[model samples]
Target: MDLITLTGLRVRGNHGVFDFERRDGQDFVIDVELGLDLRPAAHSDDVADTVHYGELATRLAEIVAGPPVDLIETLAQRLVDACLADSRVARARVTVHKPQAPIPLTFTDVSVTMTGTR
Candidate 1:
């Protein structure tokens, strides 16, 4: 299967269990992989035959950055739903990274990855 990827997309969102986390926003990076059959697009050279990365990112950002969510898992699942909603996508995987985690100890990053198929 052919894959279309959107990597290192950063957005600010309010997500966490702590009160401060909810009040304060943080940078969240999302990496998405979408499966598609590129044969038609390759031959026709038409965007309509393939998935559009910009449009997908716009939709995902709107959902992820909206409202209050306690878990990244929920957000990931929601994103998966959005990804699969596109009939062109055969499979999708979403990863959300919380770089500035509120851990007492120093760490590189915290993240979650979820996979889905249509």
Candidate 2:
């Protein structure tokens, strides 16, 4: 299957286990991989034949900014659901990255990845 990928999507969200984490909010980076057949769009030269990545990006960003969750895993699942909402997407892989997690030790980032199939 052909693939449509959106990487390094950053958003501010209040998702974490700690009180301060939710109160202060933090940056969340999201990456998505959508599996579908792009031949129809390629042949027809019409955007209707394929996913509108711009709209998808907006929706994913909404998910990030909408509600507060306790875990990146939950956010990842929500993203998978959103991706599958488009009928053309047969499979979706979503990753949610937490760069400003609360930890005493220094760390670059932490993330949760999940894949879903419709």
Candidate 3:
């Protein structure tokens, strides 16, 4: 299968286990690998033959910035569902990153990666 990857998509959201984490929003980065049979698109050379990555990006941004969630994992699962619903996508590997997590110790980022298949 051919895969199209969108990496390091950043957004701001309220997602965490702590009260403050939910109250004050933080930065989250999302990476997605969309799997599909590229034969049609490759042969036809038509945009309609494959998924519109720009539209996908917009939708993901909407979900990421729209609501508050207690866990990134839950939000990620929602994204997996959306990918499965898209006919062009056979499977997807998604990664959600939290760069501004309020941790006492110094850390670069926290992330969650998930895979789903239709």
TM-score per candidate, in order? Answer: 0.96, 0.98, 0.93
Models ranked on lDDT: 2, 1, 3
Q: Write the per-residue lDDT of candidate 2 for residues 1-118, one digit (tens) a residue.
A: 9999999999999999999988999999999999999999999999999999999999999999989999899999999999999999999999999998898899999889999998
lDDT of each: 0.90, 0.96, 0.86
**Clash count for each candidate, listed in order shown:** 0, 0, 0
Better lDDT candidate (1, 2): 2
Q: Largest lDDT belongs to which candidate?
A: 2
Tens-digit lDDT string for candidate 1 (43-78): 999888888889999998998789869888888898
- Looking at candidate 3, the ten consecutive residues that score lowest on lDDT are 79-88
Between 2 and 3, whose TM-score is larger?
Answer: 2
Cα lDDT, model 3, residue 42 = 90
Q: Could you give candidate 3's per-residue lDDT for residues 1-118 as a string of tens digits?
A: 8998888888888888899888888888999999999899899999899888888888888889887888889989887877777887889999998888777899988888889987
Q: Which stretches of candidate 3 lie over 4 Å from their true place?
A: none
Candidate with better TM-score, 1 vs 3 = 1
